[model samples]
Target: MKRRPRRSVPALLSALVLLAACVLVAVSAIQRILGERAWIDYDTVAATLHNLHWTDLATAVAGSLLALAGVVLLLAAIVPGTATVLPLAGRFDSGVARGGYRTALRTAAAGVDGVSTARVRLGRRRIKVRIDTTRTRPDGLAETVRTAVADRLDRIGPATSPAVKVRVRAPRRTT
Candidate 1:
């Protein structure tokens, strides 16, 4: 089973805030029940709520913001980010980093004649490569890049070979 990435910052902040609130409420309740001096004054809280009439707009905005935050947190916990590692086809459980695959593909594609630079984007089901070349006639450039990238992918022995798409573009001339 794939594990979800933890949103540590938001989760930690929310936990700390909830813990602090719970502690404060528990402490005040215990003190009040034991006939000791309570930290929170119920009369003052009641009066403040009773007299709070003009601040409804502010309260509504705050409530909406809180609801939006809750929705974001929920989505973050439920949604998983793109897989960073691709599983290899072998007896032993092993994988390659997506960055490593992309760098290798870029180097392989750039090695083609007339190709100045290469940018590769590797996805779960496809590999997109954009090649820039100074040559006016980039004939068969896409085919060359496609074959080279496909061969490299084959040698990597990933569980599934992603489809390769190559786009060749002329390098922009500088003044």
Candidate 2:
């Protein structure tokens, strides 16, 4: 039941970064072997490391930052992402795109009578519909919108139907 998106982008990014680092180090080493100055001065870095104190504020801060970055990358790789599509009831491999489903529900809600504007929010287990109308007597408009939305959801046919809630904004009353 775990429907997570692929982590191709992260894997590609990590590979590119590692490749770049390796290329830089190899190029510097090749230049040094050919009796030329290295792009990154390995001798100077070694000297600096030997002379530096680990208790220094700058060293501690840099180490902390590197450690934090490693932890963040680890978490990003391990965490599962949310599913972009919703599963249908019938076929195991068939599913509907979330954006398309949301658009359909919005259209259904907007098509209802007395609904001037409709906003539909699709959550993991709920669909909330908020509507505004110019009609003064919009007593049954909310229920009508709810029914329309529910019918549309049934038509689309997700594996588990989310609960539909409707709210109607009343027009201003004048004495």
Candidate 3:
């Protein structure tokens, strides 16, 4: 009997990692809130609040973080291959700029000879592109993708150098 190959171990691992990360971040935030409360007990903190109360900033911050954490966890759980984008931390003039950048990079990679699909991420200091392609001449395919990404970067002129990561999977066979 022929064995079937796995479809997406890396994707699964990434989602797990993102979920774990979101949990960790939430834990850290909660710990900070608790620590603040304990360290500056109400007896001591009340004086500061009396002088400069700002409508419960601590609760506001904590609530906001909790809400963000919940959203991140929910996205990580529900979206396949979407966890990596859960905590999108950065500055873009608008959502269009961010989406355009991603679309441009993915399109560039997909235009390469053998790439089946592409995922692109723009970080503060670096760009990462993941390409899924058939395992037909892996070395040559990788080179082709690298060249395509470089060309796209030149055209985009983003302030960071893109690190192209290629995942070559065997093409699915049809009987």
Candidate No. with top TM-score? 2
lDDT of 1: 0.84
Worst 10 residues of 2 by lDDT: 1-10
Q: Is candidate 1 or candidate 3 better by TM-score?
A: 1
Q: Put down candidate 2 lDDT per residue, 18-105, tens digits, no spaces.
A: 9999999999999999999899999998998898799998899999998987887788779877677778888567888777988999
Ranking by TM-score: 2, 1, 3
Q: What is the lDDT of candidate 3?
A: 0.63
Worst 10 residues of 3 by lDDT: 81-90
Q: Compared with the true structure, what per-residue lDDT tens digits does model 1 show for residues 93-164? A: 888777787898899899988899999987769899999999877778899989998888888888888899
Error of 2 at 69 (Å): 2.4
Per-residue lDDT, model 1, residue 68, is 98
Q: What is the C-alpha local distance difference test score of each model?
A: 0.84, 0.87, 0.63
lDDT of 2 at 18: 94
Model 3: lDDT of residue 79: 55
Query: TM-scores of the models, in the given order?
Result: 0.71, 0.75, 0.40
